[model samples]
Target chain A: MPEIIRFGDRGILVNFEQKIEAEINEQVIRLSEDLLHQHGDSLLYTIPAYCSLTIQYDPKRTNFKALSGSITSLLNRTTSPATSSHRKIEVPVCYDTTFGLDMVEVCANKGINSATLITEHTKPTYRVYMLGFLPGFVYMGKLSQSLWCTRRRDPRLLVPPQSVAIAGAQTGIYPSEAPGGWNIIGRTPLPLIQPDAEEPFLFKAGDLVNFKAISLQEYHEIEEQVKTGIYNLKVSYGF
Target chain B: MASSHLALYFAKPGLFTTIQDKGRFGFQAFGVPTSGALDQAAADLANQLVGNGLDQPLLEVTLMGPKIQFQGNGMIAITGADLSATLNGDRLAVNQGIEVADGDILQFGRPVSGCRAYLSVRGKWIIPTWLSSRSAITQNGKHLTPASIVQKGTTIRIDTSLVDPLRSSSAAIHPPETDPGIRVLPGPEFDRFSRFSIGEFFSRLYRISPDSNRMGYRLQERLSSFSPEEELISSGIIPGTIQITSSGQPIILLADAQTTGGYYRIANVVSQDLDILAQLKPGDTLRFSLTSFEEFS
Candidate 1:
């Protein structure tokens, strides 16, 4: 079941059944699409989290009570579909010492070899659960349970942009230069945010991602390709 | 045909003054903060005086305003603070528009009343807009350097065609009292606080500390109780988040606040009362009153 709650005067939160199941995520995505199609102007933005979709709107232009009622009624009437025809994006990553600052530390804590860790990480296909904390930063999930670990107690002052990290069943990429506590194991050459580009962000919520490992030489090559706008990222649809 | 410009030279940028507007909305999901004028009342009043729309851009001068010289005949209004303003060595009136010709220098001295002031010209000032707002976010460390004051030799370009001195007028709305009774609504985590702490929060006369800025206002108060948990999973925090730190003192978040925070939010100040809280300076004492949205409306 989906629930709608009040968040201050100008925002409303549409929460899905509190579970990490794929069906719930698909429902959340469908709700996001429905909200966009129904009331585009009333909403400022919709943030889709793991099990919740927070909608922010301008109070001056929107009536909160009416909007909340509409959302609740909409969710109640809509049934969950079995399949999610969402897009899948393949993200190329370099899991080397130069960009992966916490790789050695993570390896020491997990008692796993660098090669073995990299192989395990890239082997599985991941689902995009949410986009939050920073712009273009995605929270992907269902990591191999064995690889699950908690975040660093003391957050690093600066985590370089595009750094891929993992902590407590969650894996994400740093959209910009920011302070973070996640254990960094790899880095992506693609710019998560290209302000001047036609489509600024490389990924979106409900998108599937597969991190393909590349060598240090390939990393430099891809970085140059990204800089020169010569690289093309493959995106396929999943039913 | 007539064209005019204003020149303001900075002798000293009193605190942090910058160009501000209503704020940039619809960008927070993209990791962009909606930064704008700290005091909306002042910005709105400035816009009203100049016949600009309520959401139009205005200069948010903090504590003191820039020393400006008129280049042509125009009308301007100063609101927000009683900054001992003088026009060409003569005292100028606050809250009302005044006409100034070429060579007239407008000087704003020390603040005798409020912490920030708004200065508006008859014509809209031409400033570049980023993300649909002219408001400066200092935390980004992007624009507006060490100089907080719009100083001498500083050219402020204006669209003279938009200037209509005849349309200038006074704001009918009176400024709210500085020592305001701040109203707050119970938050999601209001139950986290001890009973004694809740009483003290309402009973104590907390002084606005000097360590206050656009991000948040730290209140100096002695709390009897506090929660042991210092960290929480990062969640959505808005402008009015009254988060109590590990030390038990309350800090009210404001415009330039971070997108997310982990602190426990005991209460949220209503939107109507935020203007009253913004005018508070160091040494000003405020008392909290718990109220609901229905009561506030």
Candidate 2:
């Protein structure tokens, strides 16, 4: 079940029945699209989380009761499709010692070999569940049970942009320079957030992500291509 | 730098003064926080006094206002804090427009009440607008740093062409008295806490700590009352959301707070009563009462 909760005078939070359900995440994304289709101008922004969607608006222009009632009605009237037809995006990652700062730490904690951990992490398909904390940072989840580990007790004061990290059951990419507590496992050359780009963010909620391991040399080549605006990774979308 | 326009020189710069407007909206998606005046009542009052639009730019002075001298004839008004004000050595009344001739000085005394004050002029301030807002955010010092307190030699421009004589008049408006009851509504994460913790939250009176600011207000809650092991997933947080951290201290998110947080939110302060919270100074006692939107609307 989808629940609508008031955040403040100008915001409403749509939460799912379960905290980490894939169906609920899809519903949130679909609802976000529906809201944008219906009242995009009225909305200040939509924050899609793991199992919830928070829609912020201008209170002077939008009435909370009417919007919440309308959303509830919409959710009740519609049934979410069994599976979301989303795009599959492949991200090239370099798991070298320098880029993967916590690779040794993760291996020691999981009691697994570096090669085995990398193979398992890259093999599974991950879903983008939320975008938060920073611009263009995607929060995707439910890593292989073996790769799950606790986050650092104290977050790094500054984690460089494009750092791929994992903490517990989730994985994410840093879009900008920000403080982070996640264990960095690899680095990607792609720009998750580009303020000057025509499309600022490459990935949205409900997108499928596949990690392709690349050599250090390939990483440098891609980095140079990205800087020169020549690198173009395949990105296809259906729904 | 010399300009063709007139300038107002500062005689004595008081505590803190910054330019403000209605605030920049629709930019949070770019990770830009909306920065504006802390007290809208004071800002609106000053704007109304000067016959400017309710959303026009104004000076937000903290506690005490800046003492300024006019370079040319201009209409201005003082609102917000009851900081006794004088124009050209003559005491001027609050909420009223006054004309200051060239070389005339305006001084502000210590505040009688209220933490913030507003001053407005008939013509808009000639400062550059960033992200469509003239309001300055201290965090964005690199992009738009706030002007320092108006000093004895500092000068500001006045657009005589935009002045409206019809808007010049002084009206008396008193600030509201401090209220003790702070109303609140149950939050989305309210059920996550133990029943005893919720009871303690409602019954206990929390004092506004000295470490309060535009970002948040840290309150001293009884730590032993609640023991939460669940690490809350970071979620969208808004102004007035009372988030209790791992150490069991309650921090109320405010205007310039981050968009998302990973702490448990016990309750949300009702919108209508947020102004009351904003007016509270350090050492003030606040009692939380559970309520809903229906109580205000």
On TM-score, the candidate that comes out on top is 1
Residue pairs with backbone atoms closer than 3 Å in model 1 (clashes): B8-B151, B8-B152, B9-B151, B9-B152, B10-B151, B10-B152
In terms of lDDT, the best-performing candidate is 2
Candidate 2: segments with Cα more than 4 A from true spot: A9-11, A40-45, A56-64, A78-101, A112-125, A175-177, A186-203, A207-234, B1-20, B24-35, B57-78, B81-113, B119-179, B191-195
Chain A of model 2 scored by TM-score? 0.93
Docking class of predicted structure 2: acceptable
* i-RMSD values for every candidate model: 3.6, 3.4
User: Residues B1-297, candidate 2, lDDT per residue (tens digit)?
Assistant: 233355777766677667778766654533345557777777777887777887777777766678787787777888777777888778887888777677887888876776677888777567766656777664433323345224446666756566444654666666656546878888878998888888888888888788887667888655467778777666777668898888889888776666667788888887666667766666767888998756431
Give per-model TM-scores.
0.83, 0.78
Full-model lDDT for every candidate: 0.74, 0.75
lDDT by residue (tens digit), candidate 1, A67-157: 8877877777756555757788888889998888889988898999899888888887798876666656777887877678889989999
Q: Judged by lDDT against the true structure, how good is candidate 1?
A: 0.74
Task: Write one digit per residue (lDDT tens) for candidate 1, span B70-120.
Answer: 777777788887778899889988888777787888887878887778887
TM-score of chain B taken alone, every candidate: 0.90, 0.86
